[model samples]
Target: MEFDSEEEAYDFYNAYGGRIGFSIQKEYGNKVNGRIISRALVCSKEGVKGTDKQDRRIFSVQAIDVELASDLRVLACNAYELMGRKSSGKESIGYLKVDLKNYLRTRRQKELLYGNAA
Candidate 1:
């Protein structure tokens, strides 16, 4: 899915069981190259200017696949077409919220009926 804003992108990742933490590694001189690269969608807020103040609001989604530009473009275009709105970030947030709510309900049911994941 396309993401219009960065926060929405992060929220999507978080919904996918991705955690924010640290990874232990060789700190001194071991630099991993291709093994650590991640492809993601990015969103941005545009800035508006005025004499005193300006409303700054814009959303963007980017897909990175150097050799698969056509695929990425198609995906983005389809997402836009499907959403029927310009904000992909908003769509991502809505999806995440729905998923999280369902997850919480299932977790509660499991805890009430049985014991929890052992």
Candidate 2:
């Protein structure tokens, strides 16, 4: 559940996302001193393509800190599991959004304790 690098986070999420009927996209925030200051994973429907924000759903990974990336990955996987239990697409996505918010809160707590290590 813990990753030492962003690549590991991506690999784990992408593979799991594929298995659960979604695709993961990496979104980077502004840079600081040539290093990324923030990062997130956007999990959308598999094969859905477009720049339109409405066409896809997004999940923030909270990967700015290497240490917290593992937590974020666990959160994502948990959301995926919650999503898998739903029979309806809309219902599943709704579950994911709610679960993601709770996970984000937990990630913030970890960030406060550990500080960003990027």
Candidate 3:
């Protein structure tokens, strides 16, 4: 079940309805190969909030039902590691950031209107 790349992880998340959003960062030069990658650690916003701190909320690429999950995890981890490099290029960082921000804003607005954090 260990994923060999991050794409598998991303696809899995997407299939499971856990993906909020994703984008690939743009690169002008060819020094770094352009790769389709996810920029954020995203999950289903409807899941149990408190469970994120427990084992149930942990993101595991190796625990999937398929064999390529490990590779996906590795790819995601590598993307995160190289995210700050000048030579490296991103493909989805912008979209991911925007989605996260909008999601947060919506959540806050709902909380204010409902009077309960939910």
Candidate 4:
């Protein structure tokens, strides 16, 4: 398929995704100088997932999923603490807070995208 502009391609994909009961997102792009030469659009759920840093881990520790915060304000407050007693009452931080934020943001984006889908 060919499009005169990137916006045209996006609009085409977005409309198609709406009809197919899914969401579209800009996946990747290649540019020459300052102009975009190519663009990739894909389903909202498709992407490189967050990965655990294996090299730094001394031993395998089973992670317990916990609801850290219900709202944005609480998440902001709790983001600073490094490995406090939260999960299993153990003083250990599994991952960096920035990684957690990114994970949440990605998850929230997918939810919003699919929730609005037709």
Q: Is candidate 1 or 3 superior in TM-score? A: 3
Model 2: lDDT to the true structure: 0.51
Query: Could you estimate the TM-score for every candidate?
Result: 0.21, 0.34, 0.24, 0.40
Model 2 clash count equals: 0
Task: State, as a TM-score between 0 and 1, how close model 1 is to the true structure.
Answer: 0.21
Predicted candidate 4 versus true structure: per-residue lDDT over 5-82, tens digit per residue: 999999999999999999888754544444666566778987542344531121112111313452334563364352
Return the candidate ranking by lDDT, descending: 4, 2, 3, 1
Stretches of candidate 3 off by over 4 Å are: 1-90, 94-96
Task: Return the top candidate by TM-score.
Answer: 4
lDDT of model 2, residue 37: 39
lDDT of 3 by residue, 40-70 (tens): 3344444333422222221232122111422
Error of 2 at 71 (Å): 25
How many residue-pair clashes does candidate 3 contain? 17
Give Cα-based local distance difference scores for all models: 0.33, 0.51, 0.38, 0.53
lDDT of 1 by residue, 34-94 (tens): 1212233322221222233122212222211211333344443444333333223333222
lDDT of 1: 0.33
> Ten residues in a row with the worst lDDT in model 2?
58-67
Scored against the true structure, residue 81 in model 1 reaches a CA lDDT of 39
Judge candidate 1 at residue 15 and give its lDDT: 53
